[model samples]
Target chain A: MVENYNDVKTINTFEIKERSYFSILWGRFKKNKMAVISLYFIIFLIVVAIVGPLVSPYHYTMMDYTALYQTPNAKHWMGTDDGGRDLATLIVYGLRNALIVGFGAGLVEVFIGILIGAIAGYLGGQVDNILMRFVDIMFALPSFLLNLVLVVVLGRSLFTILLAIGLTSWAGMARLVRGQVLTVKQLEYIEAAKALGASNLTIILRYVIPNSVGPIAVALSFNIPGAMMMESGLSLIGLGVMPPMPSWGGLISQGSRWMLSYPHMILFPAGAFALTILAFTFFGDGLRDAFDPKTE
Target chain B: MAQNILQVENVKKYFKVGKKDLKAVDGVSFALEKHKSLGIVGESGSGKSTLARLILGLIPPTEGDVYLLGKSIFKASKNEVKQLRREIQMVFQNPYLSLFPHMTIGSNIEEPLRLHNIGTKKTRKSIVLNLMEQVGVPPQYYNSFPHELSGGQQQRVAIARALALEPQLIVFDEPVSSLDVSIQAQILNLLLELKRKTDLSYIFIAHDLAVVEYVSDLIAVMYLGVFVEFASTEELLNEPLHPYTQTLLKSVPVIGGEIRDITISGEIPSPINPPSGCPFHPRCPYKKEICEIEKPILKEVKPEHNVACHLY
Candidate 1:
């Protein structure tokens, strides 16, 4: 038996190199048509937000007395707001501001969540109990109320709003990451890592965190839209981005006052806001589907 | 004579389940010589896997000491324990779960070398490739993820990873149980070849008596977290003195031989609240009055043959 084993020739076939993580993700991501369309729409929205103001004849802060509440015409596209500021310029710049807050606050939330969740999950025992209990307490308070309190105390600014939304939103993410870590830690590879003499930090950063990225990525996509909605909610109550800065939420708030006479003002900004949120939701769902290992 | 590589002295691991203590490993004692394999045979929950974990230092023993090359592991400092990991490695039962699914096979094998800071990046790659060759894993599968490989292939990768550090002792915890019968023979042969090539000592844990006999020099038959018989492989196979060991041997299907009746009865007792006297007395066919009233200690019946039974 040993002789026969030794006599067998080694197969030396060479194949193409393995696909990278991004390429594989892109391959799966392209299969869903709605997700692909949503991605393109988001990208287009971002481009318009960035470059649209620069190309327009009117600036967001520019007010013309003659064009007040003008309907859509060739001279001033998408009409003019009550302030006579170009609605197109305000909407585009408003989108830019919303995107900034969404990404900034979303990243902050994910970072804090991952840090707390990874530590809680990897350490386990007393440390896990303490941290998870803290997360549970945080979850008990309505996030909007928490954000409201923070905005009121800190005095509404872009940074304070970002901080409030980020601080309030991470409890859900931390919980998700903690559950994922708990499951991943029980796999035999973790024991194998421990047996191989890997330190706790190295194992957490290299093995545990990397494996938990799929769920984290999905959570992150969902968080962007969530942050944007929170910022909008705060804005509706006069605590959002201060006027003249032109946020989507501020525009909607301004438009609501004139709702009886001209419904176009509310319709324009609300439509934009709804479209942006829908795009994010669709994109996040696609990511969740793409990253689902069971689908593979 | 070869020096002793491992000495497990009266190791006990008890877990607190609610109000009662589960005696997972109850006062097990044994020593393994350098370059020899000691097979521990037992049913599931017999504490065979628990004993392996204790030796690996994955879980701390409730009592007793494990000495590797004359250095006490339980008493070692943090740094000493870290260094001890290099001397011992393990191959877990489920190959699919044992390897990281995200990493390629080559990177998975290279993980330990990186963890220990053993070699440069170039040297680590070369070492991984060499290990892949040694384990008969095709070079082409090196870049593939674990899920891409068959169960047998994944096990070969796991073994190669265990061999990467050149540890003196490798604990095989039913390493072939998840593979097909034909693949089991292949993996067994591979293990035998690796043993011959590296002069590595092994603590092979399995419930299959035949598989254990094929690889082990010394055999230990465990019942309810304690050894019922300890002897040389040949002696235990030829003449098992303990009734538990005899019933276990008869249960192994032998082709073209007179089939003996399977005499063992009763389910294994729960370790949380085991019987007061001998653990096997409830199932032993030759249980006497003494067997039910008092526990039996392992007593030597012949040279290198110890049986823990009243009959002995």
Candidate 2:
């Protein structure tokens, strides 16, 4: 509508600043107050996880034998556990461990999901049928049981647990990404890209994936919490990180034994885990709403 | 003989729908000369869009070949096909859906240049600016996304992107049908101006006979999956030989052309199980016993004029 020919000539000297995709995504993402709060909460959790242990006077392994199962006080916050380890320190370190597994396993799951989904969606027909069938087969197995089995076989460690969670959880993400890719690939712009002589890889990376990023981002947000929950569940069953490492799930399991006598032990770690998952879910939901073009 | 920029030799494209093969484009052949425009007018299910895809090499034909600058596009290797793409481009109908929604107008237009590894960044930018100007897109809109612009503006950007490669032949699949009448005229004028400035051949596909007549040098009337009539624009409009072409011309709401009741009965038959013999026989008012038994091939009835009707 700005149709002045003379003004057009002046535009050559006018440098246009490019607005990157992430900036636009951020602009949309910030609109949801709940999502924004959730994002801040996630950032806070990450910071505490990374820097909390470094600054804490009490280490997760260090135990005070004189004050066993002491309630919250200045000397010991969130009380001491059955082992007389500071529950506050254990909670912080436990949160950090949960987050590591959440993010690490979540990223791996997303990577696998995107690869399989992109392939299935872009190359429909026989390739789609085969890959999607594999996804169906994966869906048939009880994912939690499979993760437990994997942890048991591989000898439970952070690496094996992360791998187990990532391997089992990707099928759902792959299915979600595949559905998004199918729709995006059919858009007229994709055909236009093909006509422009864009290679399959170029079309997928540049157009299809970027267009479908909204749903994928939403899926990623949800996957982190899902992975964290999986890790917690495994740890609760005594198949998670060993006793030396303080995991949120392991702490909750230990606290459950003293549920009647010491409620604070179960309360602190369980609350943190629940709050973290809740924040992620809210953020993921908000992202889904924000990225949904139909919502606008 | 003037150089033929593109030649389609009996190109046939069939899709299997259930147990039957849907003949989307069957034995269609035509040659487009340099700088000449060929308008393909057809109804919704006439395979005009499919024909455009075949020419663009987005989909390969079941039989025959498309020759671009004397090279068979179907038989071309991956590298050869990539090279062939630089010579041919396309403008889709829905401008809203054609341009990449995520990219800025400048980036969308510069995409082909980047894809083909054409000019340096500075050169590509300048080229994009020039194309934007040529397509009547203002410079301020260069950094704007597709959704920010109106339907007409988005189409102009699509045109600019198509022209970025300086392709010899550009297939326009009802480029202006999705815009307002006022906007359609503006875009049509821009296309005409471009055609004059650059000797670019166009395969313009549209269901609107009037719009097709305005821009086409040669007009082909397609019904079902075949060309019912093919001739120069003026001759086809003035003296339409095929019954289908006459009906199409009559259907065009003229300002004050002797108001007479002209109607054709029946619907376009499904391509999957097309009517026996002539595909249009079911809809043809002048259908005879032979028309239902034998299919008529396109034959020259006049110099540079061809028709595929038993009556011919």
Candidate 3:
């Protein structure tokens, strides 16, 4: 038995590289093939959104009346829309705006969520009651209608759309973060931190926030896609990015009338929108499993 | 003579659960001299943990006060209470849970020092390295996260963190219970060696009589949130007076001696609605009619030996 144990120990003594918490998470994330592929796709889309329009053969507003409602051809790879604008250029610019709205609103949602959630969760009692009641009211409201009203009132623009979606959508994220903070704050480590004389703020920022990062990240991933889809929906109704500014939703809405005549127009923009949203969902699902503390 | 390192003047902690109040620690009192170890032995729900929390000021007592170095913690100002933390530390039962999961072992050990703003960055690093060395943790584990290390190693890191500020009193709440039997002995021996080399005092809480016997200069046996008997280690082990204490001793299997029959049965009653009169009366084999009607206060039956029983 002793010899066998020694042999097993020797076999197990091969060099294993040291890993930090993030590295461990990355290792788990890498194990999911679909998530990894989705992550790469999202990165590619972001890169395309940034650089695609800058290198497009024609400007988004440069119309070609001769090619109006044209099908896919050498001159216009994805064909021309009703305005005869290059479908490729329109799609690129639309993607850029959509990406901005998705990520920008995502930032807004995460910030507000963490701030309200941490405060409410850490300072329970009357404060919790007031804040959570407010959250409950927000949850009761029709989020899409609220977004629509804000956009119509504020006027259509990238900034307005991002704010409308972000401000209205943060209630769910706040509730998620609040639940995470509640559980994390009750752990013995938090009590240990308190016994070590760490202040309430330090405990919240260091212990509560770091422990809740997994759930928050997962929530943010889903929020990005949710925000993007919401933006598309708004744009489809003609209140999103406005004219002269191409967005996936605006392109899809314009191409719908000419769908039978030129299917490529709606197909290109809608396909990009659907695929990006799917990528984010897959990535979010992957993150949920990867960041789960109990997985190991 | 110098003052005792710690004094608990009838500290009590009652938690409101729904409509009823659970008296977790009902007016428990004790004092410890410098460099002495007081072992508080009790099974689950005996308020041993609550007593530790009260002493540490992690939770406010419902009544009474805890004094550290002649200052009442409950009566002290906010800053004063915060300052008191530097003089007292705690090692939790589960080393894995007690440690900050995101931090490396070195940073975990250095946390208390950093929190108190003690020493420069360079000095703190050196102090952490020295502590790790003293605790028998390897130098290579400095960059390792808490989960990377084994249970024994994580516990050593915990001890290092507790010792960073050189506290006068350290509370060990079932610190060795989470480890395996072999690791338990190793950690207990390390604690004993640490006590021998330093002027540190301890309030060691554990459910195991044998483990407590190895480290404690004094012993207090708790049941249902109150101490039933208190005596020196040798005195309590050799001549336990309270029926509950004897029942606990008999439950432990002796190495060479014949195992005494267990007289106690059934689980401990809930603190919310404990039995009338003596809390141990229902489980006490030598119970009398008087034991059911009147509560027994801990009183001395011998020099420095106390028992709370109607027979006494």
The segments of candidate 1 whose C-alpha lies over 4 angstroms from its true place after superposition are: A1-14, A53-57, A73-75, A259-263
lDDT of 1 by residue, B84-158 (tens): 898999999998998987888999999999988999999999999999999999888878888879999999999
Residue B246 in candidate 1 has what lDDT? 92
Greater TM-score among 2 and 3 belongs to 2
Worst window of 10 by summed lDDT in candidate 1 chain B: B1-10
Interface RMSD of each: 1.7, 2.2, 2.6
> After superposing candidate 2, which stretches have Cα over 4 Å from the reference?
A1-18
**How many clashes in each candidate?**
0, 0, 0
- Between candidates 1 and 2, the lDDT winner: 2
Between which residue pairs do clashes occur in model 1? none
What's model 2's interface RMSD, roughly to a tenth of an angstrom? 2.2
Which lDDT value does model 1 have at B254?
90
Instruction: Tell the DockQ for candidate 1.
Output: 0.60
Relative to the unseen true structure, what is the C-alpha lDDT of residue B235 in candidate 1, on a scale of 0 to 100? 98
The DockQ-derived docking category for candidate 1 is: medium
